[model samples]
Target: MKNSIAFSRRSLLALTAGVLLTGCEQNTFVPPPPRVVEVAHPVQKTFTRYLETTGNLAPINTVDLVARVQGFLQSINYKDGAFVKQGASLFTIEPQTYELQLEQARAAEAGGQATLKQAQLDFQRQATLVQKDDVAQSTLDVSTATRDNAQASRRQAELNAKIAEINYGYTNVAAPFDGIVSNHLVSVGELVGVGSPTQLATIVALDPIYVNFNVNEQDVLRIRDVMRRRGMTADDLNQVPVEVGLQTDIGYPHKGKLDYVSPSLNQSTGTLAARGVFSNPDHALLPGFYVRVRVPFDKQDALLVPDVALGSDQAGRYVLVVNNDNLVEQRKVAAGPREGDLRVIESGLSPDDRVITAGLLRAIPGQKVDPQLRKIDVSE
Candidate 1:
């Protein structure tokens, strides 16, 4: 009876230990819930197709102000970097000397006029006397020759006077156009235009500025194809609108039109040179600035997603999408130009796919995710 009781106690103890181990295993091995992520359908809308490029700002006109006549620099009419109007006098180069030369020229012109009048009277008299046979042919010929010489001298004097007047006008240098003038290179009282033309200053037009860019051969062909389909003439090409923005700008705030397009592509760079003109009344855009440029081609319906949702790796750009089974999968995408805060997906994503826009780190590939549906803000 003692042996039976001992055997029953050991059996009960082993059964109690097994029950405890089963309970612990059931509680400890419970799997965690799926990671939660925000998912959204790519925004569908009519999007403008743009050929995006980087370009440089340039002045529409840049001219060097130089002394055309020899004289001392008498005055600098504009301050350094001052905006001036067209035909405004900007410099005076020894006006006193030029003024005296102009006076001498005028006197010479007056003398020439008097001599020409006398020659005309003498020629008339000589011709009348010869017609009446009152003077010998030789005498008339001598008078005619004298009158001709006087006429030639008068013509020479008139030309010299005109040249002198032109030189006098050059003493006062004027702005060729409305532009901002650079600092004077030569100081006051310095002799200029002695040997070669002296550079006085530089003026750059700022209102209508140029943005220069290059389009690859492929893009050029694409643009031409669109033009051909639309039956657009060369003149219509200039009417195409262009938009630009500075590097720090959020978007293209400046508007312009296509000013020029090269007729031929560059053999070495495989690019076509193009330029646009923008009206910058505030003088905000400056020359030599690297800016973002875009030309709208046409509008079409396209799928767009938040730019922040896109990710990249060695394989290129991609986005994460949750499958119908709530499993995360990476979709490689071909991205187009950015519109506002969204990026145009050229391909590789279906309209019905649920793209993970948030909790990207937790949503691993091939793992289940509890996706929370969200809507993309197209207004931005």
Candidate 2:
């Protein structure tokens, strides 16, 4: 009877231990709630189709100032890197030698004129003497020949005088156009325009600047077709609008127009060189600057999403999307050019798809998420 009582006690103790372990296991097991993420739906918007390219800025006009006459550079009239007006005196070569030559030419011309007058008078007298039978016909012929020779000599002398005057004027170097002048190449009292024309300075027009860029053959064809479809011709090239941005700019802030298009494509590069002109009244843009250029071809409706929501991996660019069941799913997307802060989705996404735009780290594919519907900001 004592042994049976002990066995009952042991069984009760074992049952109590088993119950306590089951309670502990139940207390430790806790299922986590769904992760919270901000979501937005893709929106349809009108997007302009732009052909993006990189280009270089150039001046509308550039000239290297050179001395046309041989002489010493006497003075630099303008300061270096200063803006100069058209016909402004920029430099002066030694004019004393040219001036003396001009004076000598004038003196020779005066002497020739005096000789011509005397010969004319002699010829008249010879004619009269011959008519009176006081002089020989040969004598009249000699006087007439002498008068003609004097007239020819006078004309030659006059031409020489004019040439000397022109050479004297060349001593003063003037700006060909209104532009910014570079530093002088020659200092004062330096001999210039000796054997060859000597460079004095450089000037570049900066008001209207040129942006040169190359377009691929495919893009060239596409743009041409677009122009045709829009009832535009080759003459309308200058009317086609373009936009540009410097490397420091966030977007295209400068507006311009296409001014030149190559008639033929470059065979080696399979590209066509094109140029656009932009007004730079403030002289903000400088030549040789790298810039971004865009030419709009057409406009159409496009699906766009915020760039923040897009991520990339080895598989390509993707966006996390929330399904109707509130489960996160990875959606591969083909992205196009960025417009403001939003990116155009070329493919792989639907307008109704809810994209997770915030708390991306907390969201995982095939996991439940508490998606809070939010609107995408499209303000630029």
Which number leads on TM-score?
A: 1
- Model 1 Cα lDDT, one tens digit per residue, 172-221: 99999999999999999999999999999999999999999999999988
Backbone clashes in candidate 2 total: 0
Candidate 2, position 175, lDDT? 90
Provide the lDDT at 156 for model 2: 96
Residue-wise C-alpha lDDT for candidate 2, range 1-33, written one tens digit per residue: 999999999999999999999999989967798
**TM-scores of the models, in the given order?**
0.87, 0.82
Candidate 1: C-alpha RMSD to true structure equals: 3.1
The TM-score of predicted model 2 comes to 0.82
Q: Native-vs-model 2 lDDT?
A: 0.94
Candidates in order have lDDT scores of 0.92, 0.94
Residue 345 in candidate 1, Cα distance off native in Å: 1.4
